[model samples]
Target: MSVTAAPGFVAAGVAAGIKASGNPDLSLVATADGKPVAAAGVFTRNKMTAAPVITTRAHLEATAGHAVAVVLNSGNANAATGQQGIDDAEAMCAAVATELGVDASQVLVCSTGLIGIPMPIDVIKAGIPSVVAARSADGGQAAATAIMTTDTVAKQVVIDGGGFVVGGMAKGAAMLSPNMATMLAVLTTDAAATPEQLKAALVYGVADSFNALDVDGCTSTNDTVLLLASGLAGSVDEAALNDAVARACASLAAQMCADAEGATKVVRMTVTGAASDEEALLGARYVSRSNLVKCSWYGCDPYWGRIASDLGSCGIDFDPSKFSVSYGGITVCRGAIDADHDAAAVASHMAGRNLEIVADLGLGTGTATILTNDLSHAYIDENMGTS
Candidate 1:
């Protein structure tokens, strides 16, 4: 509902035959009027990246951050395939650009799913025509649904501004701990903005959401977060636009957390009293990445030891004696463990669909919050020998 929620953007998804499950594996998004729009993107930091990520990066640079369309495919990552992979990615871009009567450099490409396999370029190319033809003003929902891998539900968000709207769609559930950004997210706005404005808004806005998300502490080869400004509704306040973008990103990120692989509850982690904001984030990330801590969370156990131990590994100057931890605002540990709290009350708090884990470093007045999911057997079962 969100990506297409903005004006002047149409989208569609089609079964490209790249997926063995017979699901729609390819999608296309472009301006309704077939014109270039200001765009900016943040991609994966992994050294071994998919072909689409490489192509999109180069195109954004070559075109001066102006693009008319983005073509994406699922089921094959097109990574580690050397020059052929690059060629295939280029062909996908060319196919769309040619059909839309725009320069090849004005098109971006994205791919997700299995890694280290050759992409079915022929099938993807054949599906491009059908995908482009199916573009509709109300097609964002279909596009979101088509990008799913292991996710149980599609994630989308829309925020209305005074004279415009900001909307987005994202697909991600696992392999999430992003370095620069996460997953395949495309955000659009109807407000008039420069390419530089779009870039600054996105680079800063993601820090509040995707940058803080950690599903399994893994980064994929195909992470991409692209923002496009259509300028259909005319000029908008710069501050308002930025805030709208951030809100839309945060909403989608929360959805992704709830839909994480084998996850039951979403853990909202806040690390306070660190030496600095950077240190607080580092501490929270370490705790989020700890499988031991995630397992404890699944058991509804207020195991402060795991949080204390993992935060210490961030290499920050931490004092164990001054550390304290809490779950659902119930202090389970302070200097020494606090055993006077009602056990039933604490467990009941932990059993909720949304739980909070707060840590106090007791060092300084720094704070950071992140979203993660509890570890469960379904996560293991879903990932075993699959990709």
Candidate 2:
């Protein structure tokens, strides 16, 4: 579903002739009120980074860590293009800044799609004016759609928290992993936030969200999440600001899980009572990415053993006999033994688009939640197929 964009932001998507599919491949997002206090980004952990990632990181730092606009393109990942690729990414951001009457350093750039290809700068340059002209409040959704490579649907979420609003969009279907993904997300909120506060909220949000998922265990060089605060909601209390940011982060995280490629179900895996919150999170993430566990969910098999095995491999200090498992509130394992629940009922619950898997480790008072998708044969086919 397309979400309504937040106020104070304008977005546009245009066909920049980057993708062979003839879809809109270039997108631009900007704040209507000139420069906004920006708390920008986290990129992929991959050593072999893309030129845009390299350049954008420097630009953010060079500008004292502020950006008012972002330009993105798909169908060509400008990685391994060397100095020339860096020039193209910078030029794209520069062009947007020129059109918007802002400094070049105030603009950010991103790219996705087939790796190692130089961006077609001429087409992108030609499309900038049109992209700017098409900008509107609801244009964020279109921008999200334009940045997708293999994603079947554009992912977006909008949350209303009293006087403030937080809205964001993301794209990813493959090459997803912890600390990064093939994904790129841009989030905007009307709340007021200092740069430090913005950065803290984003880091905390991502640590518990995007950094916890793995689709194929591969991290893209261009993975990025950019957050911008327009301060349009005026001076909101700290409590209100926290609520707004939390809602925004939660919405974007859920969108990422739902848009997971070929994913038939979104699993909310919660692990509690571990040695620490970190250990609990580690255990949950390990189980979430397990091929056997995800496939079991896909095939409607309540294989409690796979879940337990995955937890064991996380290296957390926990006793096996004290672990418990439940699927959709039906206890499948209790104290490390089968709970003798109705298998048919559990299977039926697993067939839905959303499933909850809970694990209680009788170690200590710590808890964490991770969102993942059920792996299936179609995920392999879709990702591996020659589109």
Q: How does each model score on lDDT?
A: 0.88, 0.80
* Candidate 2 weakest ten by summed lDDT: 1-10
- lDDT tens string, model 1, 275-337? 999999988988888889999889988888888888877798688778888888888888645
**Residues 286-376 of candidate 2: C-alpha lDDT, one tens digit per residue:** 8887888888888877788998888877799778889899999999998899889988889888878889889999889989888788888
- RMSD of model 1, in Å? 1.2
Candidate 2: Cα lDDT at 253:
64
Error of 1 at 314 (Å): 3.0
User: TM-scores for all candidates?
Assistant: 0.97, 0.92
Root-mean-square deviation of each candidate, in angstroms? 1.2, 2.3
Total clashes in model 1, counting residue pairs 3 or more apart in sequence or in different chains = 0
Q: Identify the runs in model 2 with alpha carbons over 4 angstroms from their true place.
A: 1-4, 385-387
Candidate 2 matches the true fold with a TM-score of 0.92
Among the numbered candidates, top lDDT falls to 1
